[model samples]
Target: EEVYASQPDGFVDPDNPNHVYKLKKALYRLKQALRVWYDMLSSFLLSQDFSKGLQISQNPRGIFINQLKYALESLKKYGFESCDPVDTPMVEKSKLDEDKEGKTIDPSHYHGMIGTLLYLTASRP
Candidate 1:
């Protein structure tokens, strides 16, 4: 399937009032493009004898791709490099709650941390 989006700011059509540029590639905003690309790539990989790894969840049909390099770099980036490894990330009784009284950290920093953790969840969840 093909998708089209508005042309760049400098590019305009004088002849066609409602003309839109044809999209030749997949874009992030297109909801189905990711799945389409994933299926296409997966099919090609399977043809080359690459087996799919474990699926992360059943409902969404998400699959996990190993990211040892990313994990290592993330650990280093978050100052967990030299820290001792633990058997579990969180304690069974531990619960995360809103710390309304705690000192507020930078919003960007917190968001970056959340983004990294979100990526980790693809494998760990």
Candidate 2:
């Protein structure tokens, strides 16, 4: 619904894409939107001379910081390269928590997963 409330297809007001169209807001429901949005926002910030994170040379709308080489490397490092990729980060409004009664896992492994995800986020939060 949100994604539909925007300009028509392939719409980009070259005159002032950011201020007039806000192409960023319309990407929510898109495939690989997380990546696209990230790329656009980062580029926008850089264009505006706003500094916060690493600056990498990129293609237009090269969104999605999660696509970093390190992220892929981490996936291969952790043997998750073949894992099914999901469009959404998590199910909508889903609750996640530790299962106290479930079989215990090694804390180190848990920490490792956390570490890997943190790297993947690339300051996502």
Candidate 3:
């Protein structure tokens, strides 16, 4: 079905007030646009040679997507439950500097943390 909508109240063009915007991209909650969107996304996933099971759900509010469970599991696996929550990914900004006088961090510990971050970014990005 063809869909056209007038510009929003404040966004309407002064010179062409009668013109309406024609939708090219699927907009969720706009008729069957959600179905069209899923078709495009699933086809792209298939083209990447990936299997099924993309987690997504619909509710009264809207679509929901998150990796909080996976993130929590990863933190627990890496023994980060005791670590202070930092704004940065690996560590706080001040602690990032190299300390010549301090004991060097274990290479294996660094490797595991970095590897975990890489794997998470690969899937989540």
Candidate 4:
């Protein structure tokens, strides 16, 4: 996985003006950079003799591995573990209504909830 970047504004090489510099480290905020980080982490874990869990479903017909325990732990960490369960995880779009004058929710909290849902749904078919 090679990544390249153009030379900085004042640091361009006169001799090779068109040559882009190869990245020696991961750049911040790029999605592919996360893969590099995960690879590094998995390598370190393997070196330390830590076994990775498959987290597969108990059902024989399941295709994807489910990280149920981790998801439950995350929900508990966010104080939502014991909250009332619902047939649907979110509200129906058709039943939605705008509240222009209502108080705004915290951005961080909203992001956390969305992140949790993403993790939970990733393992589903």
lDDT of each: 0.74, 0.66, 0.77, 0.78
Order of candidates by TM-score, top first? 4, 3, 1, 2
Worst 10 residues of 4 by lDDT: 50-59
lDDT tens digits, residue span 38-119, model 1: 9899999989965554443334666554656667777787778898866987778887899989997789977887898886
Q: Give the Cα error of residue 35 in candidate 1, in Å.
A: 2.0
RMSD (CA, Å), each prediction:
14.3, 17.9, 13.5, 13.6
What tens digits encode model 4's per-residue C-alpha lDDT throughout 12-96?
8999989998888898787778988999999999899654534755566755665666667777868888988769877678677
Stretch of 10 with least lDDT, candidate 3: 88-97
Question: Which of the numbered candidates is closest to the native, going by highest TM-score?
Answer: 4
TM-score of each: 0.36, 0.34, 0.38, 0.41
User: Which portions of model 2 show Cα errors greater than 4 Å?
Assistant: 1-55, 58-67, 87-104, 122-125
Per-residue CA lDDT of candidate 3, range 22-112, in tens?
A: 9887677886788897888989987996545235678999997666666676688778877886675664455565778999778998898
Cα displacement (Å) at residue 72, model 1: 32
Cα deviation of 1, candidate 1, in Å: 5.3
Clash count for candidate 2 is 3
Clash list (residue pairs), candidate 2: 35-64, 39-63, 39-64
Give me candidate 2's TM-score against the actual structure.
Answer: 0.34
Best by lDDT: 4
